[model samples]
Target chain A: MNPRRRRGIRGNTSIVESVRLTKIYGSGDISTVALNDVSFEIQRGEFVLIVGQSGSGKSTLLHMIGLLDKPTGGRILIDGIDATFLSDSDRSEVRRHKIGFIFQAFNLLADLTVVENVMLPMMMIGNGASSAMRGEAELVLGKVGLAKQVEKQANQLSGGQMQRVAVARALVNRPALVLGDEPTGNLDSKSSQDVINLMKELNRELKQTFVIVTHAREAFGNVDRTIVLKDGKIESIE
Target chain B: MDFRLVLATKLLLKRKGNFIASVTALVIGVMVILFNSLIFNGVAEGILRDLADYQFGHVLVSKNDGNFVNEDLQLISYVQTFSYVEAAAPRLGSIAWMNSTEGASLNEVDKIVIIGVDPLRDPKASLLYSTVNEGSFVASRGQLVLGSNVASDLKATVGTRVDVKMVTASGEDAIRQFVVVGISKSPGGLAFDDSAIMTVEDIREITGRERETDQILIKLTDRSFQNELKSRLSNAYAEENLNIQTLEEAGEETLAGIRSGIAFINLVGYFGLLSASFAIVTIMMLMVSNKTKDIGIIKSLGGKSTDVLIIFILQGLIIGSIAALSGFIVGSIVGLYLQSIEFSFGPGLVLEVVYDPVFTLNSSLFSVVLGTGAAVYPALRASKLQPIDAMQHS
Candidate 1:
């Protein structure tokens, strides 16, 4: 049996569900629609990619799916729970427990050690820096091949290593879904390929769901599926 | 450790320049407050000491009118019976003309007030013995302790014989000769600096009033008992028509002025702390602006708005603690050094620096609270930041 269909609300396999989502930037004449009635679902444990041109709403959809922003019109469900109308605190709780994020900038606090950066999500979840939490963070870092560099400051790591640390941080809490926005945009071609490959390997090993927004679709080979966007609307799901 | 604390400390360390600047502001403000407290408290203490030691004892007893307090020995004996009464002494005050016989002086005679006291008991009731700079206090008949100024005016020193003329109680002019036994100095600009001290027996003999006293000065075990003792004495001596006054009542105007000055100094000190609070506000605001991306990152890592707020607040607390501790140590050292040096306004008048531990501790705690308060707005701004907006912020 596929692990993607193994977890969630009984028969439901979708980790993220967006229905008729619309996000408009401004009010009247100057207003621009960033997402126009876009609907999509990312199954549990599925490695998915959202590819689009500039201003094509790929990142907008990701933001809606991650619950980082509210949609002007529509609803979002995470693991079969209605997330669109949740209060800010509730949204934060959901984000803390069920989702993790990776940015193109890697966004690691430069002054903190690599292990400390990885421990951030657990810390946010109210698990203080206990020995058990430290062990868990170390175990995650080891999975990302950064066990040797756990004590090094985040800024000292190369682009690929930094992204690996970011990956470790995202997975340290064992979130139900992970969202990445241009995760490899700041890296060289080789480092970018290495990061994507690592994410693919992590997804296969842990059966973790991934939804990445990117323009470089070619680098993300062998993904479970690809959703393309154009003019703030879904063009295809392949 | 909580991650918020760890993050706050790391962020503060990352921006060493800003942290140092904020701490410097608080340090200066705290030091200013502490120094203000030291100088004002010292001045107040010195003035109060002078009033108690030289002008009035802890309490004073006099006749309601200007007449001499008759039967003063009985009054002194009664006052000394109280357990809290450290000592009591009778005093006789009179006006006379004195001229040094050994000096080349014809029109150099000076009019002065004479205060007669018992040599042995007076030292317990007052600081007369400590004020003597040249010779001893009056111990025998015809021996006088001259004020520094009076001695200077008469060209007299210890053992200089002077002739004193005054109207005796029988309405007849009487002249007497006395040798100056001591030269005493008076700080706080009291009348003692221009008068003479003699034994009460000699004063009564010259005035032809064998058993009369102008007033009785009483010293108490502790000055704080002045009010309670005053009330008791007032009731006990109501029929005698006596005027009983505490040291505070005798020098009310001077003490009130000093208290007002201290209040103003305290206001200015707190104002210094307020200015330092503004520095904290500015520094924290700049920190928020610089750490926009970091805020977004933390939020994306599932940090709550409250978490962000606490991180910045913790930063302020850390800065305040360090600065307050540093300022207290520096202020205490400087206060001690000032106390060691003699800063005189006039002869025998010097500035005193006092260090009150409770006051310093409260000032430090107040600084810490103000620092944390100053960071509120900036911390709120950081907490309210949208993750998307912050991540997009350049």
Candidate 2:
């Protein structure tokens, strides 16, 4: 109710709202709750981290918010719209125009070139295919310092380069929210730091919203806020 | 330029071995079908064409009485005037037992139909004139042309004297003496030039029917006009009760057999192509399974299921189309090679390989359709894959 308090949380603007979000796997006695009525808010342009042990369901939460999976109960709101129960195509539309994802494995299609990988979001969004999309891809790749290697295939890149390429792809559509599931987990320490630093720079210079899930504690020191999970429930916000 | 097609092409091209395997299976299946089409269609057409040329002459008109027919030849004259009619002729026929009076041991032939024809006009009606290998076509009342089979049985030459006789209903025998003026050799066909050819005068003199004609033959410029001509002729002879028929109508039993043969061959071809399509389906299933993570990644990037479907379908269509077109070329080559080989299929049944391979734009389009259609189930399954599940699969 107070604008002053709101200003402190997400600069008075919330871009994502999770209300009693619950995800249960299996059924009856064997059912395991991946997300147990957990609720949280992520603000516009804020860098947030979700941290927990492997079974604590941090990745499940990421998948729910990413629109890649549906929860058994509760709902998620992206940019103030109820996205939890949206139809598959509608969800795809939202995902295309509004959200970006970075996979821990750097899941770039090996058959495609780096530029093609980056061009994917724009193509999926169904704006007319043009050279400008590729030109925009070039600019994003340049931002990730992969301008010269655009022609290289996904497999030709190192772990760090592939992650950076993934980041470029994530930002290619200029999505309102970017989600990463341990984006730096597959990298060497040096490469992991390089990827983290690039994301930090992109968040600052572009004011891009980011919610990255990571077990790497080093990432906690760099983000605006941290949500820690224990037993599929939020234990603390720091 | 579509991203789905671009992705599909890249995927298949990178996995060149899989692509080639899919194409090879499809090509072999389609080639077999095409080859069967060629051989079966070629043989059927050849046999029909030979019948038309030598026996049926595109249309046949038969009378109830084999040895008797019209006195004025008015039916022949009327049909010959039609624009579609190329030629028409009446063949006077009689079943007679001919024995050689010259030999003490009779050269016997039982139940032979001696066809009497006008030497000048019969060439247009049948292939008998062309089959004559010795002597000449029937010219006068004392002359006759013996079929090669008959000549062999008679032990006679072109100049050999033969006695011909047929018993009438009155229990009296009508006997005639004639010299064989021509020996006709038969190549495998409906006519086989087996029946002896005689002058209309000899048949008339023997049968005592001045204008006895058993069958009327008509040659048409366009055989498709046969039905219309048959209708017209039937209407004109509504009271005469003459049996006027198209070649197809006359040879219904043979045509039906041929149709069944084609259907059986097509059934085999269908199974061949069906198994090939299953091979494609398996190939696509494996490809989609292997690319589960890629599908998840794509879905996360906002690629629609329809887009994924289009990718796999395009891959199948491209493979099918290329293989089918190449199959046409390969099958045709094989058909021609088969036609070139010769074999003896016993006595009068020599194997004649005709070369008319069946292919059309429809078949080519069908290949493309078949290729893509076979991929639909796999493609739909690929599209329905859960993004989260796929991403987590590996």
Candidate 3:
């Protein structure tokens, strides 16, 4: 390949690329390898599903990609930045500025109202934001279809509503990507379908990238591609 | 972040039980500090006023000659010469035997301060006149005035006859008969409850002593000029061995001891506040542990480590401030209540403890700063929480 064309191909291949990532847990003879030389690429603005049976290293791979965990031996490049070599605070900043996360439990702060939770990230990034930031937060909340329930406390919301609120909070900061770990795990069948459809709609309408981990095939229906992991390694990508 | 503070405040509002407990602890701490200040202020004021009002009269002057007669003469001369000198009176104090005519032989010896005064200037010159509640200064040569406690001990009332025996300047026992025309109390009422007041002529007659007095009481025109008066008197009366005792100097030892006691009380109050800080640490640690999952989520959702730290610390400071303010209010009210009631030390010794407790701007501000400062450790703990580890925490 031409050196310039090779660089271009590598750049276009993925916004995030894991190169020979390995993680070991425990000590001495009891050590277990959670990710065995796992490597993959996730393109920008791509809606992808990472599916696997239990103990398949799927969540571990997602954590490394999210910059929530350190690789034992490997490199993770996020949009050309060498993420593995970043300082703890720098990595955290990268996570904060570039990635949005959704948890299976809809991890909303129980003490905060929906509006406050959505405004939290914007306020924390740096001090001295303009008054218009709040207006932006309300607009984002409205985008997530939570404008009417903006004042509701997190704990008071129904499960489906709470998940939607979490989605709003995630997108409110305008991060480059949304990373969800079984985002619909706690929802009923109908609610689960509704949430996945909303995620898909957001992905298309906002042109924001999404990486969701789910066991339910129906939840992955609108995803452009599916990546499967088996026994601490990528089994297939389709 | 402002939002973090708002969130912290909301959390505090929601957890009303914990919030109350934290505030209560802080209030107790603040009350202790205020109470300590009140007691110290009252005790200090009481001692100062008593010293100023009872014994030391701005300044005291004695002769530089060491000869009783010449010292008294020189003191009187200096008093007349110095413009600042208000009045100077001659006094002779000695242990004397006072016997009743009934001959009960009440062996209890009395110390008689045989005051040889120019009655014209003495009352105005000394604190004695102002403190004399029962009778006027010895009006005639043969008349005497007894301290109230002294009269009560002897079962003698004013207008009764008594024989007073004194060891004169010649070291011989001299006896004289006199009528107790007046009764009075000591200033601030020290233990010297039995004192006999007599004229300079009467004391001179009984002692067979002439032109001699043991001490000279000097009053100054302005108390603030005491230092200048002392220096001038010392220089002018260099021939006589006169020593000047200013009110500020006489009570230095007692005042120092009282100040040390005040310091000890404040130390105790500080210890209480320290324990309250420890209580805050415990509460913050509990809060961090309780909200582990939430912390993890916040971190993952672009929340900086500092944000988590701020939220927790803000909670602690808020609680501390509320508690400290409540304590201030409660302590002041209690101090006021105690001050209003009179407490008796013994018969005829009632003390009205003044409890005018106040929060000085500096002290109050320091307390608030300290309360907030104590939350740092808990905040650091919250900030050090790792996103992945906290997420995995049970």
Among the numbered candidates, top TM-score falls to 1
Q: Candidate 2, A232: how far from true, in Å? A: 2.0
Candidate 2 chain B, run of 10 with poorest lDDT: B343-352
The per-model DockQ list reads 0.63, 0.59, 0.54
lDDT of model 1 at position B369: 83
Task: Give per-residue CA lDDT, model 2, range A1-238, as digits (tens).
Answer: 1112122124445677888999999999999989998998998899999999999999999998988999899988777667876888777777888899999999999999999999988877657656989999999999999999999999999999999999999999999999999998999998988888888889998888999999996754668999999999999988
TM-score ranking from best candidate downward: 1, 3, 2
Candidate 1 to truth, TM: 0.90
iRMS per model in Å: 1.2, 1.2, 2.2
TM-score of 3: 0.86
Worst 10 residues of 1 chain B by lDDT: B101-110
Per-residue lDDT of model 1, residues B203-277, tens digit only: 889888888887888899999888888888889878878888898787787778888998998898788889989
lDDT of 3 by residue, B104-212 (tens): 5552436655555656657666766555666666767888777777777777767778888887768889887888777777534642346767787777767767666
lDDT of 2 by residue, B162-201 (tens): 8888665456788888899998875564564567878876
Q: CA shift at B323, candidate 3, in angstroms?
A: 6.1
Give the lowest summed-lDDT range of ten residues in model 3 chain B. B343-352
